[model samples]
Target: MMKRARQDAMVENAAPQTSQENKKQKTCFYGSAFSESDPHGSIDWGSLPHHVILRIFQCLPLVDRARASSVCRRWNEVFHIPDLWRRFEFELNQPATSYLKSTHPDLIQQIIKRHADHLQYVSFKVDSSTESAEAACNILSQLVNCSIKTLGLISTAKPSFMNVSKAHFASALTVVFVNSKSLSSIKIDDTPVDDPSLKVLVANNSDTLKLLKMSSCPHVSPAGVLCVADQCHGLKELALNYYILSDELLLALSSEKHVDLEHLRIDVVSENPGQVEFHTIKKQSWDAFVKHSPKVNIVMYFFLYEDEFDAFFREETPVTHLYFGRAVSKAMLGRIGLNCPRLIELVVCANGLQPLDDELIQIAQRCKNLTAMGLGECEVTCRGFIEFVKVCGGRLTQLSIMEEVLIPDNDYSLDRLHLEVSKHLGRMWFPDMMPTWMQFDAKVTKTLQVKCGIYT
Candidate 1:
């Protein structure tokens, strides 16, 4: 007892270390001139501040953090810090019932028990197996005290192999929605996110929701989506299927109470090819949308059958970005000029034999805002191409014209066209080209670069 009292008295009487004393101590210990022993070997890691060590551990992944915590008792304490588990994603790869690529079940339970409340931005990216989905669902069901802000359930497996049906997924998600009332972004594509789960989400997170991207969810209907659009006035970005997009939907999004919408992406998917009995939005609705929110970008991606396109672009469409992955007809290309005045970027993956001469010219003349263009298996004559470029001028920044796309004749040559277009671009440019198989040696080429040496 007397010895313990003597040690306590010495500690109490010890002088507080000043900056100069600390610097001197560091120099004496670490910067001693020409030390024979290894300085790194004698370094005291325990002397480091808790915050500094925590920062170092914060930069590492969860697996690395766990491994590093085994080094000592101090680091183990730092590893268990609540701040370290605020944002996390479970990488679940299920090949069999016992297989696991991410965290083990025991580790996940520990995380839930200790740090579930700290989790703010969390996601579960799982493989296509039913086991993977079940694992993800199990983890989700355990998040009782979680206050997750952004949640994304991404299926790494193909949709065909996805056996974990919608009812189970939706049931699990309902728990997360009920808990995380401050959710701002959600991306649960191909999941069974039905109307009831959506209603629960809206009830909990309508005021805070900003972006929602659920493309190819078969269970969600137009009424369910309309409910979201009407309730979530703060929604700025949305990506959904074509069936949900309507006049009422667009007008609802353009409400005076909401801020100007930023991005509206539509996935025009086809369950059965050549299905023609599909709905299309009217032109009046688009006009009203444009008048209300002129800065909004409406990006559309088409994965439709050739016959299914007739239902789309029938009126003055407000699509700013358009991609035609299928073989588009000359009539459809022409309709793009008449209907899609707000079109800025156009990419045609494949088109029919009919030359888009007038249609190209009409697009360049009418759609003055057009900036980028890509034609893969489409034909446009040299004169028509030049006229299009002349109208677009420097604005056609991303022009990818394949060699086959330019059908040359006697009047407009590739060589002169390159020169004229280069003058407008203010820099040398080359069209993305393919080798001509038809009489390759006979094809004329364009050269934009000329070398002039000072010695010469």
Candidate 2:
């Protein structure tokens, strides 16, 4: 009888302990179960679902994500997820001077070792330091097994890639060019990427290549670009310096075998303004291209001086977008108004003190498809600007006129300028007032240079 009573007491004590343990396992630290809510709280963080942890890790930066993995074994698994490694920008910079926090070398190595093959859209953004460019090249060379679809080598400032040895840079670039068979888009502006590397790119990715932007690559010649045009029949978008543009390349692109080009950007830069004479694209060649790709957008960025523009806009051209980076002459603007009928967008960085009232009116009259216009250091009377808007009417989607561009006249002062302009635009419109701080901020100026295609 004594033994039986003791056994009943032991069973009663064990039952409550088991119940408490079960409750603790069911509830989370935040008073909720992984799958559902629980009233009796708390479980450890490790009990959370794998997907939830992966999602949180996705939002974190590379460094933070790596650090977070140390918190638990489950998070470490999430860190190795292939999806997280697909699109990554390798920010290479010198640690001492760069404002941007450089990616950890160990982490880069780890990524290359484990997840290089998983990367698809990859870009290397380096600062002005040659060390950073070299580091970027080293990383590029190691991506031999990567099947990247899009690759971009961007210099934060001052074409740092130029500082890298040409042989080294080309060799490193060819590693990806040879390996990534499905590369469709590449932006390698302001680099030392030569013709041979470009040929390698065409040989490997000719079938899949769609967009190629290599403006400011001084080493590529017209023949090199022609090679690409001939081989990469599926190329839809192309951007290169004016030096590489030629009648032969245009004819090749206009060939029936080639796909209808969607966009073509040419940077007309004058290293020695008066010394360099630009060759004109024959009207016949331009006609063929226009006929072949009726809806193609031909964008031209001119960084030439006043007199160097004589060869351009002398004949009928199909240039849809025109950007003048330097101070263009009044005569040049007049010529553009006459020749450029298909003009869709125009950005004039500087046009001297002469009021462009006649030219503005002429553009509104001639360019039927004109939709966007940006004027920086230019002149236009308030009446002339309002009249120009009135002529273009609701079709003018983007009209970015600096406040100073419009000189207040008797017909319209600064106060009533917006009202009259708004009436013509069919919506409220105001002149862009440049912030005083933007004048001193180099970063902002750089951004404007990119967006507006202004040189300085």
Candidate 3:
């Protein structure tokens, strides 16, 4: 009788101890044990407000945010918030050479299945692999319910989209064009997007389309772009190749029904040096465009040889920003000074072995709006450069001249050239020296190689 009573007493004492241990374990916050002495020991992380948890998830990266969703049912609910999926970039890359981590296939499927309707801004960044491009297309085709507002397909290296089947690419692109009825911006450079795809885009998103950049798209003819301009009256920015830019297209854009164009970027690329002949745009057509959009910025990027510049700068051209990726001759610079009075910025990557003394002075005298200039591999005497700067006199906002471009003369030596130029410009300046490593890089020859698709 005595032993049975003692055993019952021990069992009763151990029951409450076990219950207290369970209570302490329940006080843990997200797997972290908290002591009773800590002030936040009694706090419950799962009880946090939905918006506060959402704000925390918004600052995390895509992968991290997805992993955090599995913490609890409440956190998973916050993960499904529509606002979190508004702007997202799908980094589609190959594993062999790419340093960037590719988006998980499972995550992409979840996004398409759950949050397709919430995506407003989306972009796909792919590498120079056909597999990656195909993956992007596969994902694009599955976005059947997406209401995307802005879309961009970017290639990190040489265009891989061109390597895919044109029909396949067009079919996938048409899916987005037809489905996303409210698209405002699109940048599909170096793709195989054809005329039919562009037409579908115009048909679906004519009123909402504001910016369209389709440079280096060979399949798209001049008529295709004109169709967009005729229908999409809200287009404010456009970028295309020079081959597709015709007088008729300019006229269409300058029509009263079209909105005032804000930016126009033309890439003049010559695959064959002297064999390719360029057609000229009439001054009357250019004048009409200026009348319609006076404040428009007309940017031209030239990747043509010296002989291929015959059709340009012949008559009065209203180019505001000009970039020459090849070795421009002194004669062409002189013509630019004479014909281009509205010039604001000029970048000459390479030039012939001619001292551009008179050409520089003539440009300063004529181009009153000139504010920025960059000379890379060109010859300009120290005295002539000083005289040019004196004429502009504090109006030059950015002047990037290479050290090798300035030749020492009797009037100005290397040491004294900057001092004199600084006095005229009302600020200190120095000649840009070529870095030793940059000399071996091909990018030094063409600054627009990546963005504008103008390679040397």
Question: Candidate 1 — worst ten consecutive residues by lDDT sum?
Answer: 447-456
lDDT of 1: 0.78
Model 3, span 247-300: residue lDDT tens: 999999999998999999999999888777799999999999989999998999
The runs of at least 3 residues in candidate 2 whose Cα sits more than 4 Å from the true structure, single-residue gaps closed, are 1-43, 435-456
Name every residue pair that clashes in candidate 1: none
Model 3 ranges off by over 4 Å: 1-44, 445-456
The lDDT values for all models are: 0.78, 0.87, 0.88
Which tens-of-lDDT digit does each residue in 49-111 have in candidate 2?
Answer: 777777888899878888999988877888898988999999988877488988888989998
Per lDDT, what order, best first? 3, 2, 1
* 10 residues in a row with least lDDT, candidate 2: 440-449
Model 3 weakest lDDT span, ten residues long: 447-456
State which candidate, 1 or 2, has the greater TM-score: 2
lDDT of 2: 0.87
Question: Which residues of candidate 1, in runs, are more than 4 Å off?
Answer: 1-42, 96-100, 160-162, 411-418, 433-456
lDDT of 1 by residue, 1-456 (tens): 999999999999999989676545554332342213554654567656678779989888777888888889988899888888888888778556335576677779888898999999898877767777788888898888989989988777665214676777777898899998899999887877898899999999999999999988878888898899899989988999888888899888877876678888898888688654678787788887777778888888776767777887877888988876567888888889988888888877677677888999999988978987877677888878877888888887777666677877787787777776677666676665565553212121111000100000
- In model 3, how many backbone clashes occur? 0
Task: Quote each prediction's TM-score.
Answer: 0.82, 0.88, 0.89
